[model samples]
Target: MELDFPKRKIIHVDMDAFYASVEQYDNPDLKGKPIAVGGGSKRGVVSAASYEARKFGVRSAMAGYIAKKNCPDLIFVRPRFDRYKEVSNQVRDIFFEYTDLVEPLSLDEAYLDVTQNKKGNPSATLIAKEIRKKILDKTGLTASAGISINKFIAKVASDYNKPNGQKTVNPEEVIPFLEALDIRKFYGVGKVTAEKMYKLGIFTGLDLKKKPLEFLDQHFGKSGSYYYHVVRGIHTSEVKPHRIPKSVGAERTFSENLSSEVFMLEKLDSIAGELERRLQKSKIAGKTITLKIKYSDFTLQTRSKTIPYFISNKELILETAKELLYQSELQDSVRLLGISLANLNTEKKKAAEKESVSVQLKIEF
Candidate 1:
């Protein structure tokens, strides 16, 4: 039967201490202990830390040295990106078994739209629990899930009961849930932004919801309108499926601006290497190559060339980037360099079409 109204069932699933937990799962000795995953050097930052470490104020992106100081016995493990990606693929495959409306935010987090799930389950909470169970069974990992009518509240609820937990916020409970939420707990408010909101006496969602949209826009610019809606549990973003990428690219900002063409070419070579790695991983070919440059003054420019045949060879991509770089004049010091490949092939397009078809069937039937 045709559904009379639009029913959106969004679930946000986030792995607890994704990197660190993975390490612990692989090594039984590390379980139940404080652990972190990242570079161990002085310049290193924590990529992820166990909840035990978090109790001591350790967090991702914090300086490794500071993390160590906060938790002296913290075990440091190096990041294994390839392994993480493999597990991510495994998890995503599980999601696809339920619904094709899966949007991956990163290697360890995603939003799943399961309004018309394969199992014909009407309760989103049950679907979330089953997904978590399957992830644990398949990967030996713990994940927290949140279920709600929309993306914003779902994501927030996921964080509420973390590390092998799940929470659901029904439509009737949305307003009360948001009203008591701290302003900093709102997604877009970073440290500086939270401090700014605090200065304005905005401590809770209720406070933010009470503010005029025009006043917020005057104070926070374009994002002010965003905050206004979020406080009221309103979110309209759709889950974007992972498809064959339209472009493979890499960009890097320099520590210090360089005036020499030779230095700029060196940076371009590095970006080309990254793009080549991604292209090889995707097993995709492209016919068009583009080179981008940013001047010290922040002005940006790009030059592109399209070949007759698609190629995935790293040497070809690098050569094209070098040629583009040479074709452009060096008028100012270079602050950034980027290389990209576009105009992908039919294989990815076909796969994306199949996925869309499945999503449509789930939502309609």
Candidate 2:
């Protein structure tokens, strides 16, 4: 059965090294130099790395000490989240000018459905270029864009030209594009999945497409079906304007391994406070509270409970975390502690329909 649906015009806009760029833009001395937004301390992790730092193999989520080793002159700047948020809002405002169907993946990137845009612009390629230009004019920062018929291809295409560029995968090009794409280049296929695909002889989209639906399903379970359809240029995910988060969480890694539950209370308290602040900021609550523990050896464990009523206050969150902590004994010295709330009080959006794959003439919306 062929998958088919309305050929919507989707654009994925991703800011280039957003946090690092923001730091450079605000401080002239930092521009064109190797800089990381965070990871100055012993336990620090790099939040973002400038292109200069990336040349030396420094990357976000890498250890600070390693980043420093990679780029000896790498300057570590403390993150100014408030300033970044301000700039992110400015960029998002530009998106709102084009379409109301905007789905923010993070502060750095978003997916836009301009099938029926406010400007009545029919060419998604042109709209993507305009958006990137406006973002640069407004914020003095560059962004990359991917334009295509669906979110999956758009998202993958957006990464094709990094730093500052755009790529478009038109309806006619979608299939051949996917077939030639490296399996690692598929948006949702991560490092582990890519390795697994390699072992399965699925080195490219063509290899993935060659597998029967039953073979994929038998090997990859539910995700196998998704792979089968997406390779055929069928991804029906709609651009959600109000993307509700599945969970709100906060976590902390200690400089030293904490041996006792008593020693962890303070850290857990701080994490709960942060989680509460985030929940309050979003003006949402959840019935499920989860406590995550990472041992010194790096093994992780989680404990969760579902209360009848939703709670977003620190007192309640901390209370539940403590209870969960006491429910089980320590397997090893703790390295990180976290608290999260799920089962949020938000209505879920419905998925798009997949109908006939009859080749209808492409209509520019």
Candidate 3:
């Protein structure tokens, strides 16, 4: 059956205070207490803070000392990713029942397209509710969901009524709903971008919608076009599922073969930037770096090296990618350049080591 685009239904489900909630769920004494999931060292950062902790302004990513100052009674717990991953699978199993088009945004959140669900339910609201209830019943934790015609609206709606709540914005309401939203709250528009938009007098989605595509492009480059359409309810991003990806990286095939070492280095930089974006989007990083080069004659050469620590930053990724690029003398001019990060580390330690002044990984290239 051909699914109708106009009638497409998307649901964004997010677990509530996922890590801290999991800690509370497993240990009853921690319930209703102000708790944070992360390392307790003075230099550590809070990975997740419970609702009680939020009351005192404690938040995720805040340094341990700052979080403690905000909530003196804050209790700290180390992250147990294995437990979280187990529960994540349980929640995902519920999503798969409704639609296979489930894209996990993180260990605790996902977007599901249910335009033509297995249950044959016409109401997307019902499916969101059922999924939430199943999650609670199976995992003993609460989740919030947003239902709408597209992913952007659905993702925003999910946050509106959070911590065990549900919200739905019907097709007719997408416009007014977006118009009333703060630019800072738009999906993918981070604090820095929001501040830039504020400086441009674009504080609300309504303000953003008033700017022409040309004006936005001049001000924001390629992303300007994205904002223009997203504000007008024109997002069409699909729910791409990566059930089990062997590797996560990006590659570019050139129309013209590249031979100069200087030009090859520049291309590697671009490839690294794209790779970083993918890793950030998936909330994952890896230690293994691979460089694949395809010559103009169709011959291929691949060089790879594994480092001690996981990496997901542009500078370090580019650093390693460049090393891999120079590993062996080129056999011929390159037609395509690819960079990949395998040996993925989906579970980031809650108590990460003190922030190093520089990123240094032990590797042989």
Candidate 4:
């Protein structure tokens, strides 16, 4: 087999404790304190935790009670999404100064392809350094960067340094670096996948690399081919300047669970209206509607319907969502209901369908 990977240089930039840092920077009283951004109530979850709070093992997505238990001094602040979006725009503007091939994963992280940047700079590392500097200078917040020949290696390299630092994995160094990496650290291998790999005696990148393609394909399905090539430093996913979104979704978590289907239907209507508004506002329409239900006991179920054409109006979205909902009996008293539109008229479905050869790697750190 011939491996002719692209020689393009890529960089992954990530903000450090973005939400918490924003809170701390804007509030003088929060400086030098262990703070988290999100809910303080038991039913809520932490959106982000400051480095001070992280020292005691606090982290994002942890339940509020667990975060508080980990760090008794943890100060929880409500999320300010509007302010964060403002700063994100500033960071993205700085990135555009270097490259147009920018793919934003979220407000705090993105992948940039600087193979032929606006500045014509040859070194991706230097661009990363300058970008980080500009983010701090403009936004008064720190950012970390990883540099490499492709997104997979670049994303992993970015986390090697933390809190306003950067690391670059040269093309020559990618193989050795991946060889030394644990399988658990691979781009898409999650907890369950790692456990499955461990049971198969595939504990490291080298072990994974040694397995045959057929074996991997049989074990992991479509992602098998992706894992096979990535381990050998062969990643072809392009740095799309326009990363079409996968879905437009709206969800609500109720303070009180609803048992009656009539009441649930009302909540779904509200969610569907919000979803329609967001979709229209984004100037996007989709062919598929998904209904997500989360029960009081934390279990979840989802139903989806893909229609023939795109629709963004509230009535159509509500009708489809309601139909999907009634297809199955309510499993339990519901606490959360969400409506989302997918199968959008974009490269999203195309990218997902042909994921074997050109799969964009997502950052998980």
lDDT of 3 by residue, 1-365 (tens): 12222446899999999999999999999999999998666556799999999999988977788899888899999999999999999999999999999999899999999978999887889999999999999999999999987788899999999889999987666778889999988997998899989999999999999999999999899999999988987776667786556589888878578887678888888999999999999888899999899876667788899999989998998898888887778888887899999988763344644331211111100
TM-score of 2: 0.87
Off by over 4 Å in 2: 1-3, 273-288, 295-332, 347-365
Sorted by TM-score (best first), the order is 4, 2, 1, 3
TM-score of 4: 0.88
In Å, residue 279's CA in model 4 sits off its true spot by 2.8
Overall lDDT per candidate, in order of appearance:
0.83, 0.91, 0.86, 0.87
lDDT: which is higher, 2 or 4?
2
Model 4 lDDT tens row, 112-194? 99988899777788889999999999989999999988899998888888988998887667788998998887889998899
- Looking at model 1, residue 240 earns an lDDT score of 76
TM-score of each: 0.71, 0.87, 0.69, 0.88
Residues 197-233, model 2: lDDT tens digits: 9999999999999999999999888999999989988
Which ten residues in a row are the worst by lDDT in model 1?
A: 352-361
User: Which residue pairs in model 3 clash with each other?
Assistant: none
Q: Model 4, 13: alpha-carbon shift in Å? A: 0.6
Local error of candidate 1 at residue 86 (angstroms): 2.0
